[model samples]
Target: MSEKDTTNTSIEENVITLQTAQEWAARWRENPLNTVKAHLIPRVDINELLAEKYVVDIRAYIGVDDQGVNKLMLVGVDAAGNDLINASNGDYIYDFTQPCPNTCDVDSPLYTLKP
Candidate 1:
């Protein structure tokens, strides 16, 4: 996947059309074995990562939990492509996102097929 330019990330630049968003969501939901539709990350956690020292971008990594469920591990990345979150500190990285299955907005087109 291509990375978005984070140098001057703006709300307008990040916003996607509804149809495009729905298409992406539908593709993910296409797989029968895919239980997790999407991850619901809180704005607070994102804000914290963005506010971190020398943080130029936030990177997301896939990880497996003890129960073998896939989860997203988020961290602040510097302009030098270095992870700003100290791995030595167990809680430095953010992984507080809740999966869409249990915490989804059912009315949204991303989660349901709207008529």
Candidate 2:
């Protein structure tokens, strides 16, 4: 498929209220095994990914880092369901999240379980 083809390239905004966001986070944290509260990725990296050629969307996958820590790996996708990544070269794919347990914002409600 060509980049000009808008087949599956329609942008859909996934907007959610803060209350819902908090509730979802809280629910995820309810599971004892889900120790990693959140993952932080730089806006610049996301911007770069979105700016890539034929990158109509981004897909995130759950992964584990070299240290056995859970991580999020992101890759750009085209309208034809093709991944915009190179396994051994380039920098489009990303796994640079900072997991919450060690780098969480103490003031954020999403980082804690409500009593």
Candidate 3:
């Protein structure tokens, strides 16, 4: 298979749509990446964030860790929980030296308080 074909085994695996982001946020909301805490999360790819292109290694609903984040051993499962499919980028970790949250855009409510 071509590299592109090998890159994505799932049609929406690398997609970061609004809904996918929401689910990702909820999954990591309790514990976001904190460099001081030595927590490492997935690096947020600019292209993926803007939906311009699907960058390899940056998956849906991933947070960037400025620290050496733990490597993930990804495995895909079917709705019925059948045979497991190892992710294309298995056993990988994404980290950055610095990362910050931006809530300035109306689309993003990183710091928005709800009533």
Candidate 4:
């Protein structure tokens, strides 16, 4: 895929903001998986595809929509939080893996805060 297409697939926005705990709670109510635990991988073995070359970290947050499509945004943050990448449908599998796809680069526009 073209670089543009790859970016389009990874970038997303969180409708909820981190103003207060109440707001955070409201956001979570909309999407239960918005909690940190939801983004975490209990067993690294499940991530066999990552091998040793790639390091995975989890981050989570709540997302809200006017239409009531609240979502839990679980993202995989690299060693550096700036290098955030969205997990693939709660699954980390990729069609192919390399040093890191251009989409995975820290400077890619696809990078964003978990929530």
Candidate 5:
């Protein structure tokens, strides 16, 4: 098999979607370390729920770290409970030791209550 085919195998194994990839890219830009922490929660099952609920299959959940760095890792299993592989671009992986050039664009909550 060619390199492209090899790469595709990993991608297929790690069934990530475009929207999920974009979210990960955004998170990487916002906070690198926090992104890592978010991935640490074992109960947050991305593969199971996404496969059961959404039409699109999710192989991995991408996010940023506290240092405002982008990164992607295999954190969940497939619908068949197979281990995921890294299918993202190599150059896109952000260094978590550096400061984020841009702030997170997550929308603020519209409501606020005074205690």
Candidate 6:
């Protein structure tokens, strides 16, 4: 499909925002399921979040509308936060693993990467 086709927001994305993703990222960070304990993956169902609600995974939400590099950065952090991707600050990091096919241009410092 063409890149323009991606602009069409899916029903799932309409229900979330960057803040929501960040909050979810925090929750994911606090949860024990993201890590290994007792030789098993902890139960994350207690989080009560859907696949789309996650900061990053097969689904992730960006801080901007449509597409842009800033979105990638935020989504990258969320991806990295979830340990699904690897990225750094001061650049537009790309992760082929992201389920979304959005790749936009971003040029600003406000788009901070998570340390």
lDDT of each: 0.58, 0.58, 0.31, 0.35, 0.37, 0.30
- What TM-score, computed on C-alpha atoms, does each candidate reach? 0.60, 0.60, 0.22, 0.28, 0.23, 0.22
**Reference-based TM-score, model 5:** 0.23
- The superposed Cα distance between candidate 5 and the true structure at residue 33, in angstroms, equals 4.8
Q: Clashes in candidate 4: how many?
A: 0
Stretches of candidate 4 exceeding 4 Å from the true structure: 1-55, 86-115
Model 5 lDDT per residue over 1-115, tens place = 1112221123244344545556766775555445322222122233333443222433444555344454454333445755443335321211112112232222323212223
- State the lDDT at 82 in candidate 1: 87
**Best by the TM-score measure:** 2
Q: Can you write out model 4's per-residue Cα lDDT over 1-115, one digit (the tens) per residue?
A: 1133222232122212234323544765766653232221223232432332344664454544344433344434566663233244333322211112222444545344443
In angstroms, give how far residue 99 of model 6 lies from its true place. 12
Per-residue error (Å), model 1, residue 98: 0.5
Rank all candidate structures by their lDDT, best first, as comma-separated numbers: 1, 2, 5, 4, 3, 6
Screening candidate 2 with a backbone cut-off below 3 angstroms (N, C-alpha, C), the clashing residue pairs are: none
Q: Return the top candidate by lDDT.
A: 1
TM-score of candidate 3 on Cα atoms, chains taken together: 0.22
Tens digit per residue, CA lDDT, model 2, 26-114? 55444447677787766666776788678889886554543556566677898998877653433255655567777678778776665
Model 1: per-residue lDDT, tens digit, 1-115?
1132344554333333334434444554454476666777767567866886788898765544545444566667889998765544322566556666677787888778666
TM-score (C-alpha) between model 1 and the true structure = 0.60
lDDT of 5 at 1: 11
Cα lDDT of model 1 overall?
0.58
Task: For model 1, give the 10-residue run with minimal summed lDDT.
Answer: 11-20
Better of 2 and 3 by lDDT: 2
Per-residue lDDT of model 3, residues 79-115, tens digit only: 4543233335342112221222321222435434433
Superposition error at 90 for model 1 (Å): 9.7
